[model samples]
Target: MIEPSYYLSNIVQELKPSGIRKFFDLAAGMEGVISLGVGEPDFVTPWNVREACILSLEQGYTSYTANAGLIELRKEISHYLKNLTNIEYNPHNQVLVTVGGSQALDISLRAIVNPGDEVIVIEPSFVSYASLVTLAGGIPVPVQTTGDMEFKLQPEELEKAITEKTKAIILCSPNNPTGTCLNKKELEMIAEIIEKYDLLVISDEIYAELTYDEAYTSFVSIKGMEERTILVSGFSKGFAMTGWRLGYIAANPEFLNAMLKIHQYSMMCAPTMAQYAAIEAMKNGKEDVIHMKKSYRQRRNLFVGALNDIGLTCHVPGGAFYAFPSIQKTNLTSEEFAEQLLMEEKVAVVPGNVFGKSGEGFVRCSYASSLEQLQEAVRRMQRFVESRT
Candidate 1:
């Protein structure tokens, strides 16, 4: 008999399981639990897009697509990105379809990072960034961001975090947990740093389509940035196609080719039917996205106003369907507040500390649920906050 630990990779073992998943698991079986935990969209996958997948299957699209995904899908993505972000790509070599945006991000890190290289991660960010950087054999250097800045990464902070070993920076605009988006001006300032340092930028724009307050800016679209940027997006949030498991990355051919090498060996290709569905989404799903974004905006306003009225002091999220409110006033740690809310009030939200140390004393509440559900959750949370005060 032997211990598996003897042969296991320490990094994988040392990795903390996602706190978001842990909270979701705890609340999953609880009856009457109103979840503001997961950031999944409540919208059904658009009927038209789903129908496209069905038709593709009927037409014998069950076989694997090209390793880079369907040619037409890639071309459509090139057009979609060019029109929206004004960043043009050849499609033939610049687009690589992935299982989800996660794969695009993971493989990009694998492609670019060498052992012991440093990847600057801005927090509180999506959880995967740090772990993936580590998995890719790079050091994850976390830079703190405060809620006072709406959780936007400051250029000065980024500059201070960089060292000679720094190879890249991960930027998630319309950031997760916080739901705040970076504007063009802010991105330009970041671009100046990137250019000055000659660092690569991995811009995760998964929530780009859901921006509520202003025009979304593509980090790669910043002047002189395309050469050094890898843009990752997917059909999940905006298209409500999470189960479809479709995402794509666009970048310079050199980087994309390197990513494709890793993707081809590991994933081969994205699901064939999903590729077809995503093609339809790119071609005709704009109106559906617009409809969903409008719904999210209404829910955002409702939830934020309700939380503020109850003294939660939630940031007015500019994009994404999350409301990050400081729970500091209640004198409860984020985990305690979220856990008590679930136990006593049956409202489940993720503790902000799971996102990063800076996220302590706050909680991330997803507004992706219905207006009715959001209203009910807010009511329960209001009661919880009041008792604490």
Candidate 2:
């Protein structure tokens, strides 16, 4: 009989299963669980965007698109970026649409990382970074951020983490789990650090459209950083198109060319119907985005206020729909807090430790559910806190 352990790749063997999934599985089978665990938008894809997909199917536009994605969609993406962020890319050469920002990240890592090369990731960040870095044969050097700084990455922390083996920094603003956005001044400081080290930057701006107070800054828009920065974004969070599985990476032609090799060979183009729908989202979905942002802000205020009133300290999130509240007052570990909340309060939240060690003593609560659900979850949480007290 074949030895299955020997057949498994050593790289796969070394990777730990996702920490985020542990709570998800526990919450799954439980009855009456109100989950604020996942980071997906609560909105449906706008009716017009969904119609666009149906229209494409009606038009018999089901054949495979070019590996670089549809030329029309690429043009729309370039125009959208230029209009909003002042970043320019050629539709033909500098963009390769992929299977969501997740795929863009994986393909980018595959393109640039070599075994043992260090990739600096800011925490608490999106959970996929370390795993993707490892899969690309790189080391994930985490730079921890704190609640004192609203969980924003400090330039000094970044400076301490860098070494000669450092290949790239994965920058996520309107960061996941924490809902922290880096302002222009903060990004300028980061630019200085990047220039000093001559490092590559993979800026995940998937939540670009979700910033509450500040204009989103693209790393490529910074002076001298454009040539070395890869911008990863898509329709998932902002456009409520997560199920469409459409995302793209924009970089210099050379880097784009390299990424295209991996994208083409691995996944080819993103779904054709999704690309068609995305074109509609880019052209006519501005109002939809604004509406969603307003709802998220309202939810943010309600959730954060409830959390603070209940003795948890939560930062005023600048972007994204999450509230990362410190549960230290309860004297429960984040995991313990989360598990107990699930069991007793029947409310589901992600433990901060799932994001990183820096995330300990906190819990990530997404306000993406409805106003009623948000209100009810907060009520349950308040009762839970009182019980623990």
Candidate 3:
């Protein structure tokens, strides 16, 4: 018999399991563990959105949607993007609904990446970017950002990473893990580099609505980027609709159509009921998102302040629900610090090294839990830190 390993594709066989899931799975079996490892919203899906899904089912709308997605949901997504970025997207050709933002990212990479193409992935970013690039037969060239740089990718660093074989860049803002949101000027500078290099951008803006300090800027909204940016977003973060498994991609028609082809063959369509819910979410979900964002902001202030007070030295994240605190002072690696903290204090966090090499001295803790849970987690973390000191 052939070895099991022989049956697996070389790429899939070599791919590492998600680092975020390692701690999450460990904490799952333990009692009384406060898990900040997963980047999920603690808020329940808004009642109105749920109701919309319920109504759709009750009205017998249970069949598969158009391969691209429900026309109505696509229209809503178009309207939402237009309002947010002042850029018009034709719902008919510019938007393709996906199973989730994850699938959108996957298919976007699949649609564009050719074998041996180099894709620049900014680190420490969401865990999937590099893996997806690899699975798509592309080389993931990591460009690490430093805490001193506030975790924002610098133009010079991006320029240095580019080579003749470089095909695209995957950018997440309000970034995951670090929660750094790039301002317009910062993005424009990067955009300049992209234009000069003539590279495509897979811009993950799932956390756009969660940005606290300033209005979110869409990459496609950047001058000359409309044709080059694959804008990926979903209802999962801001609308607390993760389980709904619905997301969308907006790009130039050429790119959109290419992604739609892959999505149609691979996913068929996003859940029909979820599409209904997303329609309502895009139409009437602003208030719910605003409320959630406000709550997250309060939690961010509390959690980040407590992290700093406990000497973990975290920069206040501008968006997303994570606090990435440097654990260098503990004289332990990120994994060691996180593992010991979980064993000693029942607090779960993802080691930053899993995100990328530059993430080695930090750990990511989600502040999306209740304020009470966050406070207790912080106290436990403080105790753990003191014990180490």
Candidate 4:
């Protein structure tokens, strides 16, 4: 048996397996698991969006599109961003579609990061950031945020993490695991810091359409931040199109070109049918997004309040569908809390520590499930807490 190359890349060796996946794996094989662990929306893709994709299939649009994705889709994305976020970009050269926001980040990191370069990441962020940074041969500098601050990163934290080697800061607002959003003033402060230091920024606005209290702010909307920021977004969250595998990146031509080259080699193009569908999504998906956002907000309130009543001490997340609640009161580590809840109560929530060290003593509960599920989860959690008490 040819031992598969004894020397795997150090980048691969240094990475820790996903903390979320371990629980998911166990939950997957078990029966009667009610999971709030996954971050995906519970809704199906909008009917019209699905129809658009079917139309593309009927038209024989299965071949690979241009490396930068369909020109038509880029134009739609450009128009969509302009209408919603006031961010402008040329569809011709400023955008490159990818597998999802996840791959877009991977491509962007590969294009920009050199070996030993430092990439500042806020925690607890989505799981892919550090992995992508490692794959791109960059060092991931994790800056931990706290529940007290609603999990928002402070300007001072960013300042403390920066050094001569710093290449970029990854911003994920309406953040994963925590559901924290950075307000315009907060984002402006970060933009100021980045501009002052002349560092690049990768703004992952994948959950841009999911905000509750205020409108989503695009970094590109901030003056001078556009040139320095690479915006990453997709149809998954907004249009409930996760399985479509469609997302795009917008940046200046130089950065776009670099990502296009990597994308050309790695993915060749995003799914042609998905691109066609995305065009429809961009043009007509606003109503779909609004409907979903309204539902999410209702769920958010219900779940947050319910968790609080159950003695979880959850923050009222401003955006995204997750509720990050402390497990500390029960005197359980995040893993222990989540595991016992699953084993005894049949409730599957992700341990916050899976996202980062900062996520310790909390668990992330996604409220994208139905109201019935949310009600049941809260009842079970109440029982679990009472038992612990």
Candidate 5:
């Protein structure tokens, strides 16, 4: 019999499985486990959003939308971005609705990347960024950011990472795993480097609505960035609409058209009901987003405080619902710390190493669970830390 490797693409064969999923699956099989591994919202989709989808079904409006998606939904996305970022995109040509922010990321990379092109991915970041770059036939050059730097990409580091072969950079503010939100000043500094390098940016702003303390800044709103940035966002994080799998891209028409070709052949269109639901989300989901953001802020305070009190030093995350606390004091590799914690205390978290090499001494704990569950998880984590000491 032929080896399975002989039939598989070399890229697919060599790609490692998602590190986040490993613990999630282990926690799934355990009893009394409190999982802080996944980065999903704990809230349900707002009633109005769901009702809109239901209403669409009742009206017998289920069918594949136009390849770019429902024009009305595109218009809503345009209006939403305009309101949030103060940047205007022509709804007809600049917006492309996608299955999820993940798909938006995938197609955007595919649209821009060519073989041997290098895409700079700031680390520790969402696992998918590097993988998607690789899958798009580009070299994923990871540039590390440490907790000392609050995990924000520095302009110097970015400049060092770029070469003539560098095609683009992926920026995820209110970042996954680390929860580092870039402020306007910090973004402007990075924008200067981007301009100097003449590089494109695929800015993932899926967590834009979850910022705490300071307002979120859209990268495209920076002077001279509108044409160079591809904005990818979705309802999954803020609207608590993960299952809806609805996301959209706002970019220059040239980029949108290139991505649309791939999206047309591969995805065809986003789910019709989800598109309808997303329309309602954009129109009336502000209150829902605000409520969820407030709850996450409270949870962040509780969870990060508890982790620090237990000797795991954690930075105060400015946005998103994750706390990346240093586990170095425990004298264990990130994977070892996560694994032992799960087996001993029945609390699950993603090892920071899974994110990138600079993430080796930390672990990511999501604060998107209930307060009660977070409290219990912290207690268990304290116990686990105490035993090692």
Candidate 6:
């Protein structure tokens, strides 16, 4: 028989699996674990949305959607964004429905990147940004943000990271791991740099609806940015539809067409049933979105407060449903803290370094869990912190 590794792709062989998986698996094995690890909303998909899916199936609507996704779904997305965030797209030409925000990220990277191109990624970012960039044969240049800055990316840093090899910058506002948001003023400055450097902006707004402090701003809403920004968003986070595997991208049709070519060959279309559900979500689910976010805001306050009270020195995240607390006071590496907390206290969270090395001294505690669970997680974590002391 051929050697097992003989036909494996070299890049795939060396790629490390997501850091969240190992800790999650460890948490799963323990009977009483309260896991704050996996980064997804804990809410159930609303009943109305499910009913829409069942209704569509009953009507015999199950079939392959157009390669770009159902036109109706795309139109809903376009309308949703325009009305809420002051951004507009021509649904027919400018939007492409994707398997998830993840596939949108992957295919967009693959479509834009040639071998050896560089993509500037803000560190303390979602873990997938770097790996996706690498898989697309682009270099991931991570620019670190710190607690002092509330985890916001600095315009100066973006300017410095850009070079001739730089093709794009992936910005995740309401950033994962950090849960920090970049406000309108900050984005305007960053937009200027993107213009000066003529760089593409891959803006991931998956957690847009969950922002707390500032009104969420789409990068494409910035002047002259519409032509240069690829906006990736989805129903999962906002609508508690993670299992549905639906996402969409709104971009200049030029980029949308290129991304579509990749989507067509790999994943032909997002789920037709999910798309039907998403149409209902986009149309009438605003109340549900508000209700969930209101609950998340309370969780955020409770968890962040408990973390700070227990001496973790967390920065208050402006948006998204996470509290990124510094574990430096205890002099523990993020992995050490997360793993030990799970072992000793059965409260699991993701280590900051899983996001990037800039995350070395912190831990990401998601508030997307129930309040009671979050309170228990906080209590367990407090005990762990004291034990270390």
Error of 3 at 318 (Å): 0.6
Predicted structure 6, TM vs. truth = 0.98
TM-score of model 4 vs. true structure: 0.98
**Which residue runs of candidate 5 sit more than 4 Å off their true CA positions?**
none
lDDT winner:
5
What would the per-residue lDDT of candidate 2 be over residues 285-317, giving only the tens digit for each residue?
999999999999888988899889889999999
- Cα lDDT computed for each candidate against the true fold: 0.92, 0.92, 0.93, 0.90, 0.94, 0.91
lDDT of each residue in 182-291, candidate 5, tens digit only: 99999999999999989999999999999998988999999999999999999899999999999999999999999999999999999999999999988888888888
Question: Candidate 1: which stretches are off by over 4 Å?
Answer: none
Worst 10 residues of 3 by lDDT: 1-10
Q: What's the CA error at residue 278 for candidate 1, in Å?
A: 0.8
- What is the per-residue lDDT of model 4 for residues 31-108, given as tens digits with 9 covering 90 to 100? 878899988999999899899999999999899888888888899888888976787789999988999988999999
TM-score of model number 2: 0.98
Check candidate 6 and list the clashing pairs.
none
Clash number for candidate 6: 0
lDDT of prediction 4? 0.90
- Candidate 5 all-Cα RMSD: 0.8
Q: What is the lDDT of residue 136 in candidate 2?
A: 94
Tens-digit lDDT string for candidate 6 (1-389): 78979899888898899999989889888999988887899889999999999999999998998999999888999889898668779999999999999999999999899999999999998888999999999999999898888888888887888889999999998899888988889999999999998999899999999988778888889999989989998988989999999998998889999999999999999999999999999999999999999999999988898899999998888888888999998888889999889989998899999899889999988888888998888888888899888
Off by over 4 Å in 2: none
**How much RMSD separates candidate 4 from the native structure?**
1.1
Model 4 CA lDDT for position 76: 88
Clashes in each model (backbone N, CA, C under 3 Å)? 0, 0, 0, 0, 0, 0
What are the runs in model 4 whose C-alpha is more than 4 Å off? Answer: none
What lDDT would candidate 2 get against the real structure?
Answer: 0.92
